[model samples]
Target: MATASVVVPAREEAARLERTLASLGRQSFDGRLEVIVVASGAATLRIAREHGVVDRVLTDDRRDGPGAARNRGAAVATGDVLLFTDADTIVPSTWVRRHWRHYATPAVVGVGGPLRPLADGLSHRVRFRLLSDWWYRISWSVGFVQQPGPNCSVRRSAFEAVDGFDESLPFLEDTDLSLRLREAGRVAYDPDCPVRTSVRRHEREGYLPLLLAYLVGYLEYALPGRSPTREHFS
Candidate 1:
């Protein structure tokens, strides 16, 4: 009977937000599911309010980035579990339920799942499978946990203990949060709770270049005596 909250941070993504909201409405989780939309743009806020399934629509005119917006959403969330996903991602019907199930193990403080490509293209599919799905599985097996923003959930108490996602980090904020959550308890990777996300960034910026940029950013954050700067990715 645990309540859950899904926080979606969006900025000028009306079309994609529509699809994301629609998918969330079909969630199989029977508990008290609260959907909060932390939107920055006018169109995004409008779309979120118009959605029949959205329980709350919080505006973020500052547009401080997804990390800040997600923090805002989590601040007001009234659920035992706080689920985070992007406006461009489409989760499955059992997404919420699967994420909640992981919390049955008291040691599990956070849960992350695989990502699939929403766009249709062989290149997108192959790249996602290798870079995303395969990488998450392998890295997790070695104790390097990564919880992508598009499909990750955390215990409310554990999130508050870590002070939630670092608002200053422009990229890899979720990974930073995951690493911190590991200190509190187990951060699990659930392969069955996959979500399909948009590949627009890769399509626009070219996959290889973006991948290299992420690697550099991750290294900066992961290496000792180094910290991540406010380098905007999107």
Candidate 2:
């Protein structure tokens, strides 16, 4: 069986990490898979231990962002495939299984797509879920897709070739890495394999502010001549 290493980067997300670990323990992937939780604080070790995942946790100081943390985890990972996910997400029972299938395809280097957000409000929940779900359906039907980073996997070699993520980015480092990942190989979406994540981060940033930050991020990246400052707006 092909070995797979799942890297989950977390900060002070005790409230959500517990459930994330729980879901991981139940993944239905048909290969040897182990999780590496990149925790960037003292509390992270406690949470990982409490959740009985310290056997695979790596505690680091908060100096490095998720990109650095992920690299720290990857350095010790012993797998052919490197999967990444957020500390505040829930994997489907068959999430890993589906990803493994995709990774088995020699032509595929990375697998990922949208994350269906579960909101507290019923109306918002319905709207976001529908939109997220519909996007998956549409993207797959069109044979063009983009990953959400939190739900992505890359060939270990490809990741190393890109020198991992650009640790310089504070936020949207995932987006930066995704761009490089696309250049390395084919990236696609799995409509049936969906992961649900908390919108707390988005909630923390608020709708208008988050939307503006997203727009600024796009503009900053698109400008090419100038660069954007670290986005702490969220």
Candidate 3:
């Protein structure tokens, strides 16, 4: 069995971080699973420290971005597979196992799963089903694979080959990494290994504005000669 490292990047996620860590503790994977939390705020660090399931905790005082935080966690990880997920997401018990199974294929470099809404609100469900579920499926079918940060995993060798996520990209760094990973090998989509992610951002920032921001970011990433700005999202 291949060892795996689960990297979670957190900011001021005191209220939600515990749940994520607890969910990780329940993973049914048979291989050695290392859970690392890269946190920015004091409260987030405290919560991570209190979580007995966490194997390591690294502080990111720079508050650069999730991409940078994930990079820091990935740097010290000693696993064959590096799994990336948000502190606001709750993964299923078989999440790590499902991701690890894909690595049995030597040509598969990365695997991305679906993100279901944690909140039961109608709008939340609709947004996830449309924007996340359907979107990932269709895009992968067309050879334009994209892995959302909240639920994705990649082989450490391929990840290192591509030099990891672009810290310079504030919003669509995951998508950018997915595009580059295609050069290394195949990037796959696994719809069965779904993770439940918080919809608090949409609730706080409003649905249309958040959607529009991602749309613009996607366009900027897809179109030629256009660079991604340093615009931050929270």
Candidate 4:
């Protein structure tokens, strides 16, 4: 088993972070795993340690967006593979193992799994269908893109080559980074491996605008090569 670090980005997420940790503790890999929580204000150290996280709890006082925090976590991590996820997500038992398995081949620079909404709704269904169509296509599509961060991983070397996650463009940084990665190396999707994700967006804002907003954001970047704004994350 290779050394893997689970980098979870959280912001005032103490309540849900435990579920992520519990999910991580159950991974099937059985290797030396370290849980790196890149957070600020959300003191997850006690909960992470309580859940038996292998490495020291990490944080960024600057409170930069999740991208910045993830970069911070990656800098301190001592793993060959870097897995990026959200603190609100729940990883399946085989989450780490399945992700690590793909790296057996060198060309596989990026690997992503299913991002299933924890709760179902009309919004989730509509968006999920569109997303699935995008990711399953033999080739990448302009309007359709998949960079499901919660279940995505890449080799530490490749990540370093690309300079980890982009600190600019606070929102949709994964999309920005994945675009560069897909160009440099291959991005893989695991049909069998999926991770549980929160439906907070639906819970807060209804689905239609989000779908449209995402399209607008993607188009904004695609046509002009301009990164999205910080407020986009909100």
Candidate 5:
């Protein structure tokens, strides 16, 4: 019976934080669950408390990047398992349970699930979900399984073994973590444990460009400096 800590790194995401916490509150896990929200603003802290779901909240006034914020939360986490998700992600009722069940096998060091890109319109939802689901399925089936940061979990020991996420990476940090996790032990991908994530990146930057940027980031992660493109959080 391993306890779990859910860390959500937020940067001025008060609006979405409410929904994210709401979803977490609905989770069906019976284990000792600890939820921490590492946010940068007073508003975020207020919203987090308003939701009345999180077990703990860390106020980082520096507004550090996702990796930094998450690392800060991980440092204080007191659990055998560490689960990471974004402030904009709406996890299913079985999200925590699904990830925890994977740890039943000793060889499983980390577990990653698929992303369900959310949209308002019916057409938009269908289009984004189909493409994203297909892409993740193919990527996971191929061996270089990349976990969406908003829907991934790792054993505390294994996470400490890889030294956790690299705080310097502005983007594609999850992919880098995945590579190191694979070296330690098996990293399982469960399509059934999908999480609903915002498509705001594509909505703000255009779908094609966002997709191209992710592909470029993946290449850079796979091939290092040889890749023609560089990652940018902006």
Candidate 6:
């Protein structure tokens, strides 16, 4: 069995981090799977230790961004495969295995899964579903496959070859990494490895504004000679 290092990037989310940790604790993967939580503060470290699900805890005082935090964590991960997910996601028990199964093909360097909304509200669910489909379409139309950032895994070598996540971008780091990873090898999407991520971003920012922001970002990426959008999305 192959080993994997699960990297979670968080910022002041100690209160909600436990739920994600608990979900990870329930994974049935029997191989060497280690959880590394990269937190931007001391508070998150304390929370990660309390949950006791993480094998390693890293602290980044810079508080640069999720991409920086994840890069820092990936630097010290002990596994050949690095799994990246948000602290706000609840991964299914078979999440690791689903990603692991694809490694049987030597040409496969990365795998991305779907993001399902955990919110019970009908409107929230509908919004999340639409956004999910939009992301899938964006990945296809862009000509570079991108899996959901909150639930994706890549071989460490390929990640390093592509220079890892682009920390310079405040948003769309996943898309940047996906495009670069595609250059190294085949990047795949497996629907069975879906993770449940919080829909609070849409809930807080309003769906229309969030959608518009994403469209603008995609446009910037699609246009030639145009600079990438530097706007940050929370």
Q: Which stretches of candidate 2 lie above 4 Å from their native place?
A: 126-146, 226-234
What tens digits encode model 3's per-residue C-alpha lDDT throughout 1-234? 468999999998999999999999999999899999999788999999889989999998889999999999999999999999999999999999999999999999999999899988887888888888898899888777889999999999999998998988877889888878987899989999899998888889987898899888777765655553222110
Models sorted by TM-score, best on top = 1, 3, 6, 5, 4, 2
**What TM-score does model 1 achieve against the real structure?**
0.95
Q: Considering summed lDDT, which 10 consecutive residues are worst modelled in model 3? A: 225-234
Candidate 2, residue 161: the lDDT equals 86
Who wins the TM-score comparison?
1
TM-score of 3: 0.94
**Model 2 alpha-carbon miss at residue 147, Å:** 2.3
Error of 5 at 144 (Å): 1.0
Clashing pairs in 2: none
Off by over 4 Å in 6: 223-234
Candidate 2, which ten residues in sequence have the lowest lDDT sum?
Answer: 225-234
Encode model 6's per-residue lDDT on 1-234: one tens digit a residue. Answer: 568899999899876788898988988887988999988666778988777678988877889998899999999998878999898889999988889888778898899887888788888767766677556756555555766689889988999998898888787788778877877888887855678998889779998999899789767766665434222110
For model 4, the stretches where C-alpha displacement exceeds 4 angstroms are 42-45, 120-145, 228-234
Error of 3 at 14 (Å): 1.0
Give per-residue CA lDDT, model 1, range 97-130, as digits (tens): 9999999999999999999999998988999989
Ordering by lDDT? 1, 3, 5, 6, 4, 2
Which portions of model 1 miss their true places by more than 4 Å? Answer: 228-234
Worst 10 residues of 1 by lDDT: 225-234
Span of 10 residues, lowest total lDDT, candidate 6: 225-234
All candidates' lDDT scores?
0.90, 0.74, 0.90, 0.75, 0.82, 0.82
What local lDDT score does residue 124 receive in model 6, on the 0 to 100 scale? 73
Best prediction by lDDT: 1
Superposed by TM-score, candidate 1 places the C-alpha of residue 73 at a distance from the truth, in angstroms, of 0.3
Q: Against the correct fold, how does model 6 do in TM-score?
A: 0.91
Which parts of model 5 are misplaced by more than 4 Å? Answer: 223-234
lDDT of 4 by residue, 1-234 (tens): 469988988777878888888888788886788778876553565566556654666656788788898898889988898898898899899999999988888888888776777777766765665564344443343423356778788888888988888887766778766666765677777878878788887568766787678778766765533753322222
